[model samples]
Target: MSLVVTATGTEVGKTVVSALLLARYRQASYWKPVASGACEGSDSETVQRLAPEGTRILEEGYSFDPPVSPHLAARWAGESIEVERLVPKGRESGLVIEGIGGVMVPLRDDGVLFLDLLVQWGQPCLLVASSQLGTLNHTLLSLAALRAQRVPVAGVVLNGPPNRDNREAIERFGEVEVIAELPVLDPLNRSTVTQAASGFDTAGQLAGLLDQSQGECR
Candidate 1:
């Protein structure tokens, strides 16, 4: 089954972790629907640059000029983001979909949320969180939000310097596994991605999330 990568908030190294996962799982595909930024490039572009060669990256679902929330961005652009059309026609093994912002961000005014897409996909997700002190609250809250919506979690990936205490706290109280603790990269590059990938096995970490048989069509 396809996997999704979401975060507690923006700029939490979610894309970096996605890159590392793609680097480790060479056959994996990456998709980031409803992207808001376009100056530096989309999140899919960042993944394409950092992921291992031959990674199948899909086009963004909807792109906005301003780097703002999907709802605002789409409103400013005079376009409606449709959730029904956003779901992948089929699932593929190692298909890693990335969501914009946090799980609660809205895509449109009809109460469609990023979490709604995750619930529709009905697959487990890898929640990326900061390893800093404030992460405990944010992490647990995000976990609760996902569970409240009936979303299955693949696990958590704390993105920052190793914070054993924070990790333990999340694992103990959050009731979700800490898949890996990714340290900050010195000079973020392909090499850095490969190095970070060593922290977790590609398939081992995702086995629980991938429920459907590989390469199965819908």
Candidate 2:
């Protein structure tokens, strides 16, 4: 089964979560459909660097140098990211796709949202949400959108400091399990990420969820 990691907004540690998830499985392909703000050496480069050995790169297209929303970035680059060209390819490799922006960000003039691409890929999603205040709305809204699109969500992985009330409410009320909670570190800092990569505990958490979901499917 494939898994896509997404957030309510940008800068919510999606790449970090993607790397951790990639470390979990063998031969998992990592694909970022559209990326913006490509420096010579940046987070996208870091993602390629930190991916485990034998990992297959399915598809990646970096648009341009604007650190803005994908729609604006694509427009700035004078070319749009076509949805037709963005689907997964090759054999039945398990995937971990990371989105460029938030869930509702537009990809084309015809109103193709990012979530549309996720639905096309047809994978159980692992939402990476912030654990700070206001996360409840962000998490629930994202879940609502996913449900509206009929996407099967595996569970949510809160990607910042853990909040007891937030987690409980999302579980009890939202009815979606909180699979894992990862703490936030210094902004753009790779130290905690390096440690997490070396330790690789998120793999167990993700694997546990995948096993549970698969059994349910059977």
Candidate 3:
């Protein structure tokens, strides 16, 4: 069972969390299904660089050069994103799949969304969110949306400065565990990523979840 890593919005540390997961779960590989910012750089590349040696970084299902919404980027590139083709190939277990943009972002012109794709994939999700002001609303709303679609949430990962109040609020209202709280590394590198990962899933909670059959959040 592959774990899906997504965020409330872009630049909210999905890649960093993905790297942390890959580092923590040595057997897991990394995959970003649809990459819209190929011109700038690839998240797969960043994950590959940050993840420990021998981490398998799989090829993306769709790659567009424009750094914009996936639907628009596909249009700009004179193409369209087929949701079915985004499925992970070959390896099913021990894979970490990262999503593009936010959960509600459009994936096609016909109004399909990233959330829709997540529902289609039917895998457990680890939502990455900020640990700052306004997270209460964003995190709660995202959790609501995911639950509404019956997407099994593995847990939440808060990335940024530590905020105990926010973490408590999310865990209380959202009814999910704060699996990990990743602080901003002074110098973000493989060493720091490894250090951060060492502190994550220390009790094998996430690994245990992946080992079992998927279940909905209460």
Candidate 3: how many backbone clashes? 0
Number of the candidate with higher TM-score, 2 or 3: 3
Assess each prediction's global lDDT (C-alpha) against the native.
Answer: 0.82, 0.71, 0.87
The top-ranked prediction according to TM-score is: 3
**TM-scores for every candidate against the unseen true structure:** 0.92, 0.82, 0.94
Global Cα RMSD, each model? 3.6, 4.4, 3.9
Please, what are the lDDT tens digits per residue for candidate 3 over residues 1-218? 68899889999999999988888877777889999989899999999889898888888999998899999999988898999888866555578999998889999988999999999989889999999998989999999999999999999999999999999999999999998899999799988998888888666778854442322111
On residues 1-218, what C-alpha lDDT tens digit does candidate 1 reach at each position?
67889999999988898888777666677888778887657788888789887788888888887888899988888888988889763655567888789989998978789999999889788999999989999999999999998998889999898999999999999999998888888899987888777656544657434443332211
Q: What would the C-alpha RMSD of candidate 3 be, to one decimal place?
A: 3.9
Q: On residues 120-172, what C-alpha lDDT tens digit does candidate 2 reach at each position?
A: 87777888888889998998999999999998888887877778888999888
Local error of candidate 1 at residue 209 (angstroms): 3.8
Q: Which prediction has the highest lDDT against the true structure?
A: 3
Model 2, stretches more than 4 Å misplaced? 40-43, 90-92, 185-218
